[model samples]
Target: MINLAARDILHGWGKFLFTGIGLGLLIGTTLTMAGVFRGMVDDAQVLIDNSGADLWVVQQGTLGPYAEPSSIRDDVWRGIAGLPGVAETGNAAYLTIQMAHAGRESRVMIVGMDVDRPGRPGAPGYLTAGRPILHGHYEAIADERTGLQLGERVRLRRHEYTVVGLTRRMVSSSGDPMIFVSLKDAQEIQFLKDNDALVNERARTAANPAFNRPGVPGLLEAAQASSGQSRNVNAVLVRLEPGANPDAVAGEIQRWKRLTAYTREQMEDILVAKLIATSAKQIGMFLIILAVVTAAIIAFIIYTMTMAKLREIAVLKLIGAQNRTIAMMILQQALSLGLLGFLVGRASAGLWGPAFPKYVLLLPGDAIGGFMVVMVISALASVVAIRAALAIDPAEAIGG
Candidate 1:
């Protein structure tokens, strides 16, 4: 017996091909959404990996450095360094702000790290160009995604920083490109008040009798000077000794230091689960909507195709064609359309994924899963058309 599905598709190849292409574009968008979600998870993992720390020490009772506002004295790392199983510790400050370039401003995550220790925790893992921050204040190591070239000057708050190095794929949990600066500069930028605010603050301090008692000479000047500096950091990054248990070290730090300590796994969970949770849910909703739309479109196409071939279906029935055979024909056509659409969508996603502003990681596993879902949706969508065809009266072949 002739293959009815193949014959019908070949007979109306143009319509079938175009319909598949349209459906494929929709599928492509769904696939791209999955990739975007995957990219976010990857970006979060990259952040944890690049920090080079086994644990993060933040302010007590708070998720710090990324998820929430956490401020502790910059000197906190000194005590954390002496903890057992701690091999190295670094003071890190994170401030997401707009940095001015030549004519426009770009939002970037300004990472303050211990510049004195090159290749330490919180420093850029690798440089694609130039060297790390050598000078104490103005030098920076920028992520390539920030559009900052090596030696380019970018202003951060009150100071101009020269991008001394460029690193690739160095981004924060929110996918913001990171610009690494000295810990002192980061602290100042993160916490220091503006010049006007500072002046007003000093005047308030001088006017307050409690702080500036006339009997205590030099007290007012000392208070004003101390108010101008920022000595706070967001978190302390701790590297553990080889083979040390991260949980054990984190527990010790939390118990002894009176601070919150997050192990690598805990930090990853916070970043993926809490930090980007809303975004992930939004993407998931989009995926669900897209799946519903795709199914509806497939069902409509199949139903229309079946209705148009009603007379043919009637004639087949009049010629003693079995209902199961007709059902198989429709099922095969739906599967073929779905297969075509999936191939087009997979290719489309790969082509345009890199052009997105943020990373889009298209994993092979996701593609496989998407393809399976599409085929299943296609089969289910054919039910309406199959039912319609099975209801046809054989007498209609001769009457019409």
Candidate 2:
């Protein structure tokens, strides 16, 4: 028996090739969406890994430093350092802002860390180009993604910080590049407002009845003075001793300090599951929509191709061809298109994944799963064509 599907495809090779190319582009977009979601999860993991801390201490009843707004006394780390099984502790604050350097602007996460200690939490894990922050007040270690160079000054929140070091792949949970600065400066930049906002707040405080009363002497002046300084840290990072129990130390801090303590696992859950919930949902929806659209396109192509071969199909039936043979012919063509499309889509995703502004991690498993789904979709889409072909009357070939 001759291969009917192969013969038909060769007769219309151009049409089949062009149709598969269109489907391939659609499949490529779907693959890219999966890569984007994978990248987000990896970004969260990277954030946890780079901190180099076993436990995160934050404000009571709140998620901190990434998922939610948390405030704790800047000096709380001193007490935490004395806890049993605690090897090292560092205070950190985070603030995201759009910063300009040499007429170019990029959004970045400004990390305030303890520059007094080497290998401190929140410090960059590796330096790609320059050294770490040396001076306390205005020195910075910027991620290479931020487009900042060594010896460049980036004016941020009333202070100009000189970039002295460069790090690679140091990004926040939101995929913004991080710029490391001294704890004091980060506190001020994170908590302090602009000059005008400060003036307004001070004026409001001075006009309050409790502060501006005639019986109160210098109360308003003192309140105004206190408002200008930043003494709050968002979170404290703790490193454990070689044989220490993180849960026990965290419990001690919670019981005595009245602050929240989260182990590394808990922090990862917050960042990946809670913080990125909405974004994940959005990507899921896009994937679903793309799947539906791709299925529709495939169905249309297969149905049209089968309908166009009605005369040939009628002649085959009149010559005593079995229904299985005609059905197999259509199914084979559909699978061929799917296979070609998948190869093109996989190649496209690999070539363009790195060009994305944020990370796009295309894992091997995802690619394999995607190919399986595409093939299944192709088989299912061929159902309409198969059924239509089987319905052709053998008499039609002789009647004309």
Computed on alpha carbons, the lDDT of every model, listed in order, comes to: 0.92, 0.91
- Give the range of the ten consecutive residues with the poorest summed lDDT in model 1: 98-107
Best candidate per lDDT, number? 1
lDDT of 2 by residue, 62-122 (tens): 9897998999999999999999999999999999998987687888999999998789777
lDDT of 1 by residue, 1-400 (tens): 9999999999999999999999999999999999999999999999999998889999999989799988888898888888889999998999899877767777899999999978679998899999988889898999998888988988899888888999988898878899999998898888788989999999999899988886899989988988888788899999999988999988888999899999988998899999999999999999999999999999999999999999999999999999999999999999999999999999999999989878899999999999999999999999999999999999999993
- What lDDT score is found at residue 141 in candidate 2? 92
**Candidate 1, superposed: residue stretches over 4 Å from native:** none
Predicted candidate 2: what Cα RMSD to the true structure? 2.2
What is candidate 2's TM-score against the reference?
Answer: 0.93
